[model samples]
Target: MNNPYNVLCIGVNHVPVRRLSKLDYAEKDAKTVAKYFDTLKDKAHVTLLTGENATRTNVLNWVKQCSNIQGKLTVIIFFAGHGSAEKDENNKKLERCLWINSNLDTGPGSHQLKTSEILNLLNNPLHQLIFLIDACYNFDPKQEVSIQDIFKQFKESERMTGLKQYAIISASAVNQGALEDPQLGHGVLTYYFLQTMAGKYTFFLRRKISFFRFLAVLDKRVRNHRFLTDT
Candidate 1:
């Protein structure tokens, strides 16, 4: 009953291919986010995978392992890496993938971990999954109902069944890009996210950082970023 959430922080900066550009702060950013979760009520456990360790195979395998865990679970998946909305030859649709560490960054889409693939693996009746995507080139993921509605149901019943909760917070809107700031020493999304979590604002001292408040401040600062084009 102690560990309420299983946090997976996946960051891949070292792409082993010429087709994709290397990143500067992805590994650092992933750790930063994982650190935040570690302090979340001391009930959220974290598993971090970065650089070579964050290969597509390993990450998928880790999630698969967690899916087999019994009882109610809140799974938080955070990714900071190179992502794109490119044309998939197989489906002929715009496929979204977060580029992980692998030798094959081209031809086969297996190394490029698809967003849908991750979702499919954790599609259980008793899981509350949150996707905090810090990669570039993303679209708003579709929602079934809303997180609020799910929370209401969860609160009303001690033993709810047959459905799960989902919420996604992307760094940018569709056709937009996210970046790491050289001066800030972190990705734009990560930099501000850490600042807000660090209680830079005067709000946290007065009240615990709830999701709504934290996100409100984060969204405001990100949209107001001078160099950032979209949010």
Candidate 2:
């Protein structure tokens, strides 16, 4: 089969209306990341959409438009910021992830969109869809949240019928929060991802490395950082 003929990358830095607005930062960072994937544009169609101002509607539209893409299609979504999660009643085993937003209510029927929503959106016919979330999911200071738990939940969903082949890489573990380096001025996971792809840590992994290994190496590298914190 031919390689993927299209690519979509979405990145966000700030939650809409919540915390500090970092849409500008996310837009700038997305542009740089888009550059890294520019070589693919010549061989395959690529669409890079990003911003702190990016809403669930924007994401939904992107997913709707890309689902019908012919041939192999690679969809990448990168998120950077704070996130939270809670138990879901309808889906007892699954937890609902909440993206931080200014008007998000902590009570029942809050406004944050669920991960299932995003998953359902990309559950199309793409050859491959990669999800990279660089943010904290549980924000309760008294309690710790497990990033692994959330990831495991998603992993289990793949067993269901009709979902595309997927790979997920998070900035930290279930109980950990992504660290931001004052010196580097970016999330630790983002830094390591860039470094590995830039020939720093992957130098010894042979010339051609698979996406899984790249994420594994990057995960370990981020975990080993000195300023690790639980979010």
True lDDT of residue 179, candidate 2: 60
Worst 10 residues of 1 by lDDT: 155-164
TM-score (all chains, Cα) for each model: 0.76, 0.70
Clashing pairs in 1: none
Model 1 whole-model lDDT (C-alpha atoms): 0.70
Once model 2 is optimally superposed onto the true structure by TM-score, how far is the C-alpha of residue 69 displaced, in angstroms? 1.6
Tens-digit per-residue lDDT, 145-218, candidate 2: 36565576654432112233876666644444556675555666667777777884452213467565666677
Q: What Cα-based lDDT does every candidate model obtain?
A: 0.70, 0.56
Candidate 1 TM-score, C-alpha based: 0.76
lDDT of 1 by residue, 15-82 (tens): 76566678898899999888777776567778899988887777888789778888888887888988
